[model samples]
Target: MPNITDEQLARPFELKHGEQLLMSSPKLETIGSTINHWVHHRGQLTVYMRLNDIAVPSIYGPSADDRNFS
Candidate 1:
């Protein structure tokens, strides 16, 4: 999406999978919201990984998988 042209960014974002009555944000705000939503979900998954004793992958920096992380 970083490759998206300025013209593309000027276009309004559309939702195809949900109720049409839902409000929409601008393209850039929608992109930011989507990224925040993903990070929120990933954090939840990491909690699940901890409960199940599963290794969590690196996100912002080195994770437990890195030999020097601990």
Candidate 2:
């Protein structure tokens, strides 16, 4: 699932409630929700890492402790 592309994100997907459809969205929108959830956890973990004196890895770009971005 890593490195999903824009062409794939434009496609729609659905969730279901048993036999009934629950909801649906483009993959990009779902990604926004997932990223929001991840950011919350990332903030907490970075704080924990700082307190424990562990080097933080680069996420979007270079970090104080690392330069490799993932």
Candidate 3:
């Protein structure tokens, strides 16, 4: 999977306030995997998931998982 650039991740989507995004390499399998993981761990937290791909900037609280971009 290719690394998603900061610009790509920073691009805004049509997401609501508490929406969760599963990060993937724009591939079906990868996207599916991310979704599956998110479903399984939905009860854990309310942040978006950057699965099998790149990291997105945190808009709310700090994310130790990825560097803050915004």
Candidate 4:
């Protein structure tokens, strides 16, 4: 794995699958809330997440918050 730096952890990102770039945010909590709200209203749907300022690994698939999973 490549070394991720603090600078990299401070940048906003978008989760991408092929050509599609999903929601971009610097805060994971905000992203989670947005996704939860969407699901509550629109039913369950798969959404992508991009990490900003941190290296989030693949969970189930991949996520910016995967590194924090305990």
Candidate 5:
């Protein structure tokens, strides 16, 4: 992560991403988007763990692996 001040979060910036695409958004918007993307992936990971009979830590609520996380 880079050093970002709260004042800068209100300002827009461009990110040169893969495939030569440029993403433009306010810092706060980008941060929220990044977090949402990770959360989506994490949900998939939990499903994968369940399929493999691996214990999954509680994220939002209790799972079959443990009922103490609600």
Candidate 6:
């Protein structure tokens, strides 16, 4: 994958999840699925953090644990 590029991400691909299957672009099947799955688990982690009184960091913006952008 050393030569990987946006062109490769645009290629077609297939996916199988449980009883479901899908045909999609490589970018959607790979990057999109990975990010979506990560965010799903991240939400679960936040719940655990709250239960332990641990501050959860913002993923898309400033959080109470972090406010400075600089």
44, model 2: CA deviation in Å?
Answer: 1.2
lDDT of 5 by residue, 1-70 (tens): 8997889998986787666748789989988999999999999999999899899987877776785644
Candidate 4: where is the Cα deviation over 4 Å? 1-4, 27-70
Candidate 2 segments whose C-alpha is farther than 4 A from its true place? 1-29, 67-70
Query: How would you encode candidate 1's per-residue C-alpha lDDT over 1-69 as one tens digit per residue?
Result: 468887777677876656664555679888888999999999999999989988887889999866779
Error of 6 at 38 (Å): 0.9
User: Cα lDDT for residue 38, model 6?
Assistant: 96
Lowest-scoring 10 consecutive residues by lDDT in candidate 4? 43-52
Q: Candidate 2 residues 1-70, lDDT tens each?
A: 5997889998987888898988899988987988999999999999999999999887677888874444
Can you write out model 3's per-residue Cα lDDT over 1-24, one digit (the tens) per residue?
A: 998775665554443356665442
lDDT of 3 at 68: 50
The local distance difference test score of each candidate is: 0.82, 0.87, 0.52, 0.57, 0.85, 0.78
* Structure candidate 5, residue pairs in collision: none
Q: Order the candidate numbers by lDDT, best to worst.
A: 2, 5, 1, 6, 4, 3
For candidate 6, lDDT tens digit of each residue in 1-70? 3877777778877666875876556774678888899999998998899899998788777766675745
Q: Is candidate 3 or candidate 4 better by TM-score?
A: 4
Point to the candidate with the largest lDDT: 2
* Better-scoring candidate (lDDT), 4 or 5: 5
Residue 12 in candidate 3 has what lDDT?
A: 46
The candidate, 3 or 5, that scores higher on TM-score is 5
TM-score per candidate, in order?
A: 0.67, 0.51, 0.25, 0.27, 0.67, 0.52
